[model samples]
Target: MPTPDFVLALREHVGHDLLWMPGVTAFVLDADRQHMLAVRRADTGAWTPVTGIIDPGEEPASAAVREVAEEAGVDCAPLRLVDVRTHPPLTFPNGDHAQFLDLCFVCEHTGGEPYPADGENTEARWFPLEDPPPMNDRFLAQLQIVLADRPEARFRR
Candidate 1:
């Protein structure tokens, strides 16, 4: 993942310490709703739905779409807001600590083949709902919401 300029500026002061950041996750489903794109994140090498940190001043919905585009070279038509949650603080191997407030969305794939579009993700593929690649526990929860077709989104209080 390319560190954004905003984060770089903050790191100058914080220096890998905990930073409260905003993020977006897109559960990009196919038109039939039976498949979705998952990308192997470059940092973790773990397969997850396209996700990225939201830049300062960016809307969550737009960030979600942009993440999918950047990571997977895919266009998405957002279906609805699905869930919002603060991911538990994670400390990187290099000792950078951060926590994310994530806005999750369920989007339909509008165009483009699922391919590695940016260096953030090494691989991208469409997976069937019945047999998704392994994912982190947090992402698995988001996958549940996407698969359940939840009528309403989970909003942060």
Candidate 2:
């Protein structure tokens, strides 16, 4: 299957000049703490947390807020930094090669209903913590770390 335009652009940029750096991922929780907001990637069908690449001039916290709004159409106030992770350098299917340092924050949803804001995501829904959507082991591990009372954990460099 052909890669999506965004992926293609990412690959091209990374393959040539741009270098991907630290990014932020958000695990947004509802007021009742019964649900967590997640987004389904259109390209990979992976039900993952809301995340985005931190722009050059942007702070990681601000990036987290922006990404949550962009990917999940929700306003959130990040409660605290939860976990920091690093993905090994690898070439994406679209041919982009780069390493990612992910800063995962746990945030509380402040406003707006969950919905896909744009091309970044296809579906946004509140998932019960007890019966979360299918996700990779890495993501599950990160979620566990965030839910734990510890300050933060680092993994997979």
- Judged by whole-model lDDT over C-alpha atoms, candidate 1 comes out at 0.89
- Residues 82-144, model 1: lDDT tens digits: 998987899977788999888899999999999999888889999998898899888888899
Which candidate tops TM-score? Answer: 1
> Where is model 2 poorest over a 10-residue stretch in terms of lDDT?
1-10
Locate the minimum summed-lDDT window of 10 residues in model 1: 148-157
Q: Give the runs in model 1 whose Cα sits over 4 Å from its true position.
A: 155-157
Task: Kindly provide the TM-score of model 1 when superposed on the true structure, using C-alpha atoms.
Answer: 0.93
- Over the stretch 1-157, how does candidate 2's per-residue lDDT look in tens digits? 2333554566555554334567888988899888889999987889998877877678888899998998888999988887877777776555456677889888899999999888867899999988888989877887787667476555545
TM-scores, each model vs. reference = 0.93, 0.84
